[model samples]
Target: MPRRTLPTAEDQAARFVRQREADRKATAEDYVELIADLLREEGEARAVDLARRMGVSQATVTATVGRLQRDGLVETKPYRGLFLTAAGTALAAEAKARHDLVVRFLIAVGLDAGTAEQDAEGIEHHASDKALTAFARFLSERGDTT
Candidate 1:
C-alpha cells in the first residue's frame, strides 16, 4: 500500500509535523497489550522481564508502566512484579486478539513462525480494527489453520 501523504494545513505545518511524529510513536494500547500479555503468561513480570522480552531496556518498560498505571491498566509495586488491572486485562485481550490475527495472516501468506511473529508485532500495532476484523473473517473462512 502506498503511504498516504499527510494533508497539509495553512500555517499548521508545525502541528502537522507534531501529529506525524506522534503517529510514528508507539501507541499506549500497544504497550498495554504487550505488558498485559506478558503478565498473563507469566502471572506477573518485573519491568526487566518485559524489557528483555521486547529487547528494550528496563527503563523503557518502567516508563510505559507509569503510563499504563496512569491509564488504569496496571498496578505495580516497588519490590514486586507488575500485574494488569481489570482495564488492563481488557486491553490486553484486545492486543492478544490483534496479535493472533496478524500471526495467522502472516502464516497464511507463507511466512515462517519466527518471521511471522516479528511481522505480526508491527502489523498488529499498525492495522485498523476494520482491517483486523476483515482479516479475522478471512482467516475464519479459510479455517484459520497454519
Candidate 2:
C-alpha cells in the first residue's frame, strides 16, 4: 500500500464538519421517535409545555411539530394541545421499547436513568434496526424484557 499524507488542521476540520453534517442528518431521523415518546408519556401537550418538558424552546418545538404535522404523525391546532396520530403512537411505542432495552443494558452495566437516557438518545437515532433487535433478543433471553 502507498503511504498517505497527514491532513492539516484545516483539512481535518473540513472533514469533521462533513462528518458532523452526516450525523445531524441521522439525528434528524430521531425527531419522529422523540415526538412519539413525548406524546406517549404526556398524552396531548401544548407546544410550549412540551418545550418546557423537553428542555427546548417553543420555537424548536413548533418547527418540529410542523414537520410532524406535515408527515401526518401529529395534529396541532391553534391554542390547542398536540395529539399523536395513530401512526405516531405506534412508531413511538417501538422507539420506547428499543429505548427501554438500551436503558436496561446500560443499567445492567451499572448506569443511572439520566445517563442511560442520554446515551440511549444518541444510540437510538443511529443504531441499526437489526442491531437493536438483537439487543432486544439478548434482553429477552436474560428474562429482563419480554
Candidate 3:
C-alpha cells in the first residue's frame, strides 16, 4: 500500500472553491425537488411550508425562493403557492435520478439500506455524471437495481 501526501495550500483552496460551487448547485436542486414533492403531496408549496420542511427560517426560504425565481426555476404568485417552471421541474427530475443512482451504488457496495440512504444524500451532490453513469453500469452488470 502507498501513503499519500497532504494537500497543498493551493490545492485546498481550489478544492474548497469547487466544493462551494457544487454545494450551491445542490441547494438549488434540493429546493426545486422539495417544491415539486410538496406540490405533489400537499397541492401547494408555500414559503412557510417550505421553511417547515427544510427546518430553516422563513427569511431564508424567502431569500432562496427569490433566487430561484430569478434563476427561472420557480414562479410565485401573490397569495398563491410556489410553482415550478419547466426548467425547475426538469432539474428536479435530474436530481432525483442522480440520487437514486447514488443510493443504488452504495447499496451494491454492501452498505445497509439506512446508511446508503444517508450517505447518498451527500454523494449525489458531489458525484459527477460520469461517476454516476459508471455506478449505474456496475449495478446493471450485477443485474441488481435495488
Clashes of each: 0, 0, 0
Tens-digit lDDT track for model 1 on 1-146? 99977556754797566556545434666666767666667777778877887788888877878887887888987788887788877877877777888998888879998999988877776676788888878888899744
- TM-scores of all predicted structures: 0.74, 0.68, 0.88
Candidate 3 lowest-lDDT run of ten: 124-133
User: RMSD, each candidate, Å?
Assistant: 4.6, 5.6, 2.0
Clashing pairs for predicted structure model 1, backbone only: none
Q: Name the best candidate (by lDDT).
A: 3
Candidate 3 per-residue lDDT, tens place, 12-109, comes to: 99989988989999989989989999999889899999899889999999999999999999999889989999999999999988988888889889
Q: What are the runs in model 1 whose C-alpha is more than 4 Å off? A: 1-27
lDDT of each: 0.76, 0.71, 0.92
Q: Report the lDDT of model 2 for residue 37.
A: 57
Clashes of 2: 0
Cα lDDT tens digits, model 2, 54-134, are: 688889987877877877778876666777788777766776776778888777668887899889877765566687787
